[model samples]
Target: MKQARLHFYAELKDFIAPNGQNKTIVHNFKHRTSIKDVIESYNVPHPEIDLIIVNNVSVDFNYIVQNSDDIHVHPANASIKQINIAPLRHLSPQVSGEPRFVVDVNLGRLARYLRLLGFDSLYCNNFDDKTIAEISSITQRIVLTRDRKLLHRKIINHGYFVRVETPKIQVREVLARFNMYSFFKPLTRCTFCNGKLKQTEKQNIAQRLKPLTKKHYEKFLVCSDCNHIYWQGSHSIRVARLIREFSKTDSPLS
Candidate 1:
């Protein structure tokens, strides 16, 4: 077996085994092994890697490991000057128009929060890993999951391994990672069904509203798919506050 040394930089270190953290790792491998497989062997998902340098030269994922070669892996959002390096291959897809997502089964709350901000977040609690991967591949939707293994699928071109566990913090993490603060359009989507919301006249839906709702609110928004009515009731304050919080604390991309 041949041996090479790899150093994972920045947040990429978090994915590696504890003994290898913040240091160079001596990896023993076969002669023709690709760098992509080597990196994933350490639990660093390819989607999270932005650049790889082999012996001071930037290399792509398919670069074969050479015995005694030195490799450096950098995460997405890492600050690196690109003057002399090979063109960095950003693993994340070039998303045009509004960004869309297919959330994993366990990230239902994250999906709802994303939808609340008017982003197209498709989610179902019963979505198996294969189903989510298929949807992401077909729709070009970014996959959001806490499961690192799901991002390893070859068909998933755009995906993220969500590190934060709390839904509120997880949404902020995603916004920061994707630079999506400018895309916020609160209340323009149905949090329940990921449907677009359309303004509906109060008189048209008067029969559905409670007496107090009819008396107090003049404007309403209805989900195009689910037909769920929304008005600026007591919940609006909490929604507004949450929006403000998300806008302010996007945090830096890790």
Candidate 2:
């Protein structure tokens, strides 16, 4: 067996086993093993990895592990200096501009929360893994999910595993990871159907509003797809608080 030293940086350490955090791990391997396999074998999933440096040079996941190789791993979203290493496949064709996301079956609430914050989030609880992968590849949407297996798929190039359970925390996590504060446009989309919202005259949606809603509100936004109506009412303050909290917190990328 051949042996090499592995070092994980930033949030990637969270996936490191209890006794192994922050230390160079000497791993024994046989045959020709890809760095992707080696990393995942040590519990860091490929999707969470952005850049890998073998020796002093940067390399992608497919670089084969060699005896005595010193591997330095960086998180996909870590705030670090630009390096010459080729990013893992999932990091491209470059994460600039406003990024769209595809939420998996378990993240319907997260998908809604993301939409509430103006990110273009697509979601369907019925979307199987294959469908989600296809959509992400075709539309170049980043796949967001709580499932590590989904992120492991070869078809998925851009993806993230949401670490937290609460929807608000997850929102902060995503915002921080993607550096999406500039794109945040609260209440721009229908939280229920992932549809764009248009300002509709009160009278146009008058029949749809409840007596209290019609009595109190002068204007509304209607969903383009389902015509769901929105008004600033009881939940407005909560939404405002969420925006404030996310604006201030530099949530961890894990």
lDDT of 1 by residue, 48-127 (tens): 88788888887888788899999988887788875367555555456676789999989999999999888999999989
Instruction: Give the CA lDDT, 0 to 100, for residue 86 in model 2.
Output: 47
lDDT, candidates in the order shown: 0.86, 0.83
The worst-scoring run of ten residues by lDDT in candidate 1 lies at: 245-254
Evaluated against the true structure, the overall lDDT of model 1 is 0.86
**C-alpha TM-scores of all predictions:** 0.91, 0.85
Task: Please tell me which predicted candidate would have the highest TM-score against the true structure.
Answer: 1
| Candidate 1: residue 3 Cα off by (Å) | 0.7
Clashes of each: 0, 1
Stretches of candidate 2 exceeding 4 Å from the true structure: 79-93, 250-254
- After superposition on all C-alphas, the RMSD of every candidate to the true structure, in Å, is 2.6, 3.3
Q: Model 2: C-alpha RMSD to truth?
A: 3.3
